[model samples]
Target: MIEQGYNFGYLDENTKRMIRRALLKAVALPGYQVPFGSREMPLPYGWGTGGIQLTASVIGPDDTLKVIDQGADDTTNAVSIRRFFHRVTGVATTERTAEATIIQTRHRVPEATLGEHQILVYQVPMPEPLFRLEPRVAETRRMHALADYGLMHVKLYEDIARHGAVTTSYNYPVMVNQRYLMSPSPIPAFDNPKLDRMPALQLFGAGREKRLYAVPPYTPVRSLDFEDHPFVPVRADAACVICGSRASYLDELIVDDGGTRHFVCSDTDYCASRPPLQEDAA
Candidate 1:
């Protein structure tokens, strides 16, 4: 049974239409952030209201939804948001990364490679990569319009001078489609490499900022870096203890007062599906 007093996906039909149109514009622009009529969601502004809106606009009855926070499916925010969509839309929900048609994520992309059929919606707190460097909105707009990103280049150069490398580990800026510089959420630099030439369509929504953007399938996304010091994706030195997978991102777990730390895969679905490391019987 559908919930009353709220339309499908908890958004009214008119608002969905407006957002759909805005989404079309966003896709067409391809990395250009487009302003939209951001409606007040039942949830708080910063708590993935933007992603929920985008999910609502795109999801259907048959679509399987997956929500994750920092690459964990069982985390509090991910659980709550998944439940919210299920209650509102009654759509099928799955924790398995491969099973979801539309995956809404915050701060990390899944370790599993997303296919062509899937769409990833990122919850963006700050859509503009230049906001930290330049506070004024009007000036930033002009800079983007003129294809000027000198400030960004200078910042990267300064980082190289101080740290001997481009030290931006997360929320690394990238040039999308060879035009716009975009923030690929707060996903670690490890995940930034997956953003390029991906089969899945990536969309970003910033509710508080009232803006949205996208990266089409197979789009070229190059992380901003200098020629001398090229971009590199850093990962934990240790492999996951349980899964024994070195490729996946890991979370450090401190075990005892002696400060014995163990590493585990941050991606729940990917870790769970992998076979246990074989032990040698001598």
Candidate 2:
């Protein structure tokens, strides 16, 4: 009953309609972060209100929905979002990456290959790629409109000047279609390759920031890095502790309060779904 008078999911349809309209424009422009009137969801602000709105706009009777956070379908927040869709629209849900037609994700893209018919919706805390360097929303809008990204280049150059490389490890910015710079949400830089020329469509939603953006399937996406110092997506040197896999992003976990920790693949689905190296071992 989030949309009822008791809750209203923290925003009404009029605001959602505004966001929906902006999303259409973003799809048309491809990489342009269109400004919209974002609405609040019953969930926390940093959560997935933007994803919820985008889902509401496009979800139809025939679509199969998937929701993931940190790449695990069972994460509480992801499960909550899946249930929210069930409550609102009663769509079927799946954890299997192959079965989903629309995947709403946070922090990681599914390792499974997404088909051209699928749509990947990212829950974005911030859609502006230049936002960290320049905090003012108004200023960034001007930058996108004019394609003035020299500030971003200078910042990257400054990182090389001091740190010997681009210091950013995740949520790295990329140029979309040689036009607008967009944030790939907080997906590890490992996922950057997936964004490039993918068969599936990619969309970003930032509710708190009031923006929505897109990268058309098979569109170009390049991370900000220099020819001398290229970008790298970090992974654990070791395999997943539970379901051993070397190809997925790992979450470094602390076993004790002392902070002694070991790294494991953050994308549990990817970890679990990989073909076992040795069938006899299983």
Candidate 3:
């Protein structure tokens, strides 16, 4: 049942309208962070507050919501967000990626491909890609205005010099529409390819940072790399033990104190939908 005494989707109608206006500006300028009046949510920072606010803003009574953390629907963060939306909006919730009209995600994207009808909302801890390299916010904004990405290229080159490859496995930087450098949230580099020319719309909200950005459908998103050292998506070589999926990203788990390890699909819905491996194949 929908929670009483709270507006639909939890936040008031005016706040939702305000967020949607910010979202419009974000979609217009892909990868450009637009400031929004970030509201205080029931949850604390670093706990998907931005994503929750975004989801609440866009969701309608007809929308089907899905929440995933590190691509798993059953994780504590995912489950809590899903339940929270269900309670407040009373909208239908599902674990299936294809079924959801909007998917609020943390850390990882789903293994299944998204459609044009779907929208993906990301919880971002830090919206600025140059935050680590440049601590001053004003200078970073100036750099972005000038389209001066020399520092980012230099950082990647330094990584190659020290590690022989780009060591940034998550929060990988990308060039959006050949114009702006964007941070694709904290998703593994393995999922970076999915962001390139994605049919579905992508939205990012950084609640603590009070920033919002977007990538409209079919927008160009290229991972930053050099010709000699092309961008490569890396993942575990082992197949999923449950579903025998060789392509899906796997999470390594320690089975015993002896340090024995096994690999399973990080995407629970994708794993569950596939036929399990035969006893002999296992």
Candidate 4:
């Protein structure tokens, strides 16, 4: 029996059906945004309502859900979402990346390699890649319909012309399946390559805008770049002080008043899973 004051999966049957239909269409046309009836979630629009809605639609009793914000599971927003799901649907919640069946993320992808069994749902504030160039919704729709991405190319080229290289660091636009241009959320460029031919199914939901999109497992995702200047993922040269991982994304923390700072893995789960630093080293 479902819990009181909440429908199964925290969403009503009718809303779930509508979202499921939209998801099916999104998966069928990979990288294409499918508009749906975005119901007003309890959470605010910019506070991961899209991801929560998507999760509510797809989650099952058998599914293990994980929620993360800026790569940390213990953050207030992440914890609230996880607890909300547990309260509503009574589904198991996990912090481990590999153990999760579905993960709702805000800014960063997990440091661990996701497998085919996992589904990643990203909370997207903006899904239209060409919106900045042309604000008109109708004009942007027409541009996408015609596969006209010249404005994006020109913008990148101008960045190269001014700065020796493309300066776009986050929310790097990607060409999915060699057709549609998709935004991979606000994840840094370092995580951009991870989206290419990844084993996990990726879904993007924009609640305020009432749109959702998908990238099927093993689909090709190439970052937009000029022929002469290729796309390069940038990261700090320093290693994480806590986990000693150089590859994982690092967060700078000021430790002392003397301006002593340390870089640590932004992924709490990733850092916790690593071997502890030696006492002698500490």
Largest lDDT belongs to which candidate? 3
Itemize residue pairs with steric clashes in candidate 1: none
Question: Residue by residue across 1-282, what tens digits does model 2's lDDT show?
Answer: 223432223335676567667877888998888877776567878888888888777777678899999988899989999888876666788888888999999888888878999999999998888877899988988998999999999998998899987777788889888888888999888888889888999988888887789888999989877778787876668766666676777888889989887767677667777665565553
Please list the Cα RMSD from the true structure of every candidate, rounded to 1 decimal place: 1.6, 3.0, 0.7, 1.4
| TM-score to true structure, per model | 0.96, 0.89, 0.99, 0.97
For model 3, how many clashes?
0
Output the better candidate (2/4) by lDDT. 4
Instruction: Give lDDT: candidate 4, residue 220.
Output: 95
Q: Compared with the true structure, what per-residue lDDT tens digits does model 3 show for residues 9-126?
A: 9999999999999999999999999999999998899999899999999999999999999999998999999999999999999999999999999989899999999999999999
Residues 1-282 of candidate 4 have per-residue lDDT tens digits of 346877877778999999999999999988898999998988889998888889999898999999999999999999999999988999999999989999999989999999989999999999998888899989988887888898999999999999989898999999999889888989999999999999999999999999999999999999999778999998888888887898899888899999998999989999999997887866
Q: TM-score winner among the candidates?
A: 3
CA shift of 140, model 4, Å: 1.0
Q: After superposition, how far is residue 37 of candidate 4 from its true place, in Å?
A: 0.9
lDDT of 2: 0.82
